[model samples]
Target: MALPVASPVVIRFGRLGDTVLLAPLLRKLHQRYGTPCRLVSLGECARTLYQGSADVAQVHWFASQHGWLWTNPRRLAVALALRSMREAPFYICEPDVRTRTKVRPMLALAGIAAEHCVFIEDIPLGEGEHWADWLLRFADLTPAAFAATPALDASRQLRAPSIRATPDELAEARAWLAAQGVDAAQPLVLLQPANKRTMRWNGVRAADDDDKSWPVSRWAKLASAILQWQPDAHVLLCGCAAEAGYLASIRAEAGLPRLLAPTGGLPLGLLRGLMELAHSMVSVDTGPAHLAAATGCPLVVLFGHRWPSMWVPRSASGSAVTVLGGLPHTPRVDQIGVEEVAQAWWRLPPRPVDIVPAAMGERRARVA
Candidate 1:
């Protein structure tokens, strides 16, 4: 018998990393309802998170509204589109109360009934609470359904496939590196010195605390250390063009060879593909860290204020060492010193030979 068609459920999550973290809950919703669920996302980043996922039937970009009614025709068009679809049960998934309060009225104005909405707030749990499991509770799933073990197991299978770089792209990248006398085949370590705009803490004004970023100097130190371990190991610095000058400064101070920032000027898809080819990735709590997780690349994630339990990758094999020693939700990377991050890197197990190599040579690559 066909399952009863309920109102369409819509999830409103803005950030890319948050959406990735919420994948398990979305999966559970799809399993339970087996209905076409729509996602109302904020921008390009959120759209990328849902890419290649079976859970989301369609994604609508949320536009700014001037009044209670959607002044933006695009939003009205989306509402009309939703109305055109079957009048299934509609649900708004919000894990935070503040966001729920802010978006609830807006959703209501868009015609979502209050009764159909659900909020999953900060509920207490015993030791080793899996947040993904906790999120399923809002959907009427039992504790068994909320179990993390199965979720983690499923994550392993759903890991994103490596973005395959075309021959022309590879040739161009290699030729550019070669012209600069950089070894194209050597093991390369990519360092992302900056987090996404939303994740960075601008610093506290109390105690005369000065604003700072996770020191670029620390990355220079790590790059030198990696090269000491493997003399052929080259360092590539990657980020937006605005970050290129910082990379240049770091390169000059460290006096190390610098490869082109693949992230600069490249489309999001291409950059992700190049990241898949790296030996290992080290990033502060950011979008690149989440992207690295999707590639199944071994990652050393430095955390200051965020809860690692709630945000860390689900794969057991993919290790995350978070230096969270402060009040919850207040991630201060300054509190996490260079030595602490170094220790985390030291603790990371050596990359398995079965994993993808920095240079895609004759070696057989592992299934990502």
Candidate 2:
């Protein structure tokens, strides 16, 4: 049976990886409904990544303050939802458990009955299933149907995750690279070494933060090794603008002053452009790895203790996005060696053409 094609909405909020991982679920929605969707998302960066999606019709950005519901009522969320989807018999999919509690109440306030909403808890949580697969389940897709869908393209995204930039944005990124002494002709290897690895709970022991990060020292070593292996390779160290000092420390620690550093405030769209142009990427489990994968960039993703089968980016056929993990059962990021990572770097095919030259090509390159 054909699902409704009009005014379907998906509500999701989390870090960049969570947004990127929504690719498969979004594709399933489009396949079932045969139309793009409206998205209710949070954060400017996540909004930037999904706003122009071919599978998503519109994105409603929700800003949550750090105070009482009275000051920022739950009604605000319902208004945001209704603004995108009115009384037109809409479908709502909420994938995150964290948001489920709040979203249910918001929908009730908007007078949406129970049947209209889809929650993760409603679906049977499969053991060791990838979250993307879990999302398909939440959408009521059968396993066989899930397998039949074009997962590679879908995992790339309903539209491939891109940092579509205007001419000025492209020039700005190129100029920054040039100023950092990056050779336009050489292979650019991007290094994303830092992440928001910890979040506090109850002002006590940090929860949901484990060893997903490779140390800065490890990153420095890996950067130096990459330089040694590819002498002409231009290395760009990337992080959120707030991590400028941290990125600098890695460069300083590696003692590679010529390493390119974009300003911390570089827009996410421009950053995606830079990723698309790069020869390859090396990072711990971070959002940029997933973004790089979307661009068809060869990547070596290091997992400290995270499950690669569950969390690694969707890669295309012949994708060099290698996943290196620690011992089975007890993964440790620090346990992974520089030599092991360097081997993965060596496995990547030679760098393709610099994207700066083909700056105006199709935003999503069909990864062959």
Candidate 3:
């Protein structure tokens, strides 16, 4: 089969973290085709998430979790939207069987055929291959690979799941941070203690039994400990407006000064700025954690029983990152103690910031 006349069309949908991981493949495909790629997802974040990237030409997404009645229309709508664009190669990045079946019809509705599509399940992963790396490898199968002259440093944007923030966005975020009293001259600690699984009650299971839960009380203690360790440090309980309630709970429980909650959730652009500006972060295995790592924020991430190598957020080269739990034998993230989190966070070599005298004294003794 020949390359599409326009560019590659990638169908990959995931939660925020999964969406972030898709960056590498889009980048690789764009370089190989010398064109910005079109993206399809099950959720809406991809647009805002990729707003600053030229590599993603457009993002089309709809709800996928509901029953067929609601989802099928959305699927058709997506197919209709893509139909307006030129024909392109389709890469289905999901390994899930149900998801793959769901996407096939969408492609069909768009008049894209099987030969033009590459289901990721067709490519078995190499031993211990992370999914992000697997996606990067999948990008190599494009017809562009056989050309005499290849892209310079072709497919080399593999370091981390990066998101670009525009200069205007960064400046806007800085102004907002300053207004919120986020003193750049002091140690800024960001915390992501809420996950969708735990935040929404499903009735069938307790949220605490899940991997994402680490006890809201425990989060309070961790925040207090951070404040105690660095009096000048500002702890921001970061999440979307929906999770503002959880943020409030943690802020109230911690009951200490210098901890602030954003009035609404941090916008994607501002969130990127926060990740870049923060000295470090502590989070459970979640989307913002992935985003934070991409921004080169030193991360102390708590993992569940799943294999860490499969889903752990990869920070930029040589940045501080500590992965605790996620071992095969690990039962749950709650099994991870508050002290363990603090120790891992303390061990991270502080990201460069203009430190106040009070915080500077503590960082020198703790970073080593």
> Which number leads on TM-score?
3
My TM-score estimates for the predictions, one after another, are 0.71, 0.80, 0.87
Worst 10 residues of 2 by lDDT: 359-368
lDDT ranking of the models: 3, 2, 1
Candidate 3 lDDT over residue span 24-60, tens digit each: 8888888877888888987877887887587887788
Off by over 4 Å in 1: 1-8, 63-80, 122-131, 141-184, 197-212, 262-267, 316-331, 337-340, 350-368
The residue-level lDDT of candidate 2 at 330 comes to: 39
lDDT per residue as tens, model 2, 140-202: 532231243332333433323333344555576677677777756666788887656622333
Q: Which run of 10 residues does model 1 get worst, by summed lDDT?
A: 203-212
lDDT of 1 by residue, 53-131 (tens): 6676667765543344356676555555554433354555565666656455555555654444455553444345555
Sliding window of 10 residues with minimal summed lDDT for model 3: 352-361
Which pairs of residues have clashing backbones in candidate 2? 241-264
Task: Write the candidate numbers in order of decreasing TM-score.
Answer: 3, 2, 1
Off by over 4 Å in 2: 1-5, 65-68, 73-98, 141-172, 198-210, 263-265, 316-318, 326-330, 350-368
Error of 2 at 99 (Å): 3.1
Task: Find the candidate with the highest lDDT and give its number.
Answer: 3
lDDT of 1: 0.54
Candidate that beats the other on TM-score, 1 or 2, i.e. the better one: 2
- Judged by whole-model lDDT over C-alpha atoms, candidate 3 comes out at 0.76
lDDT of 2 at 354: 48
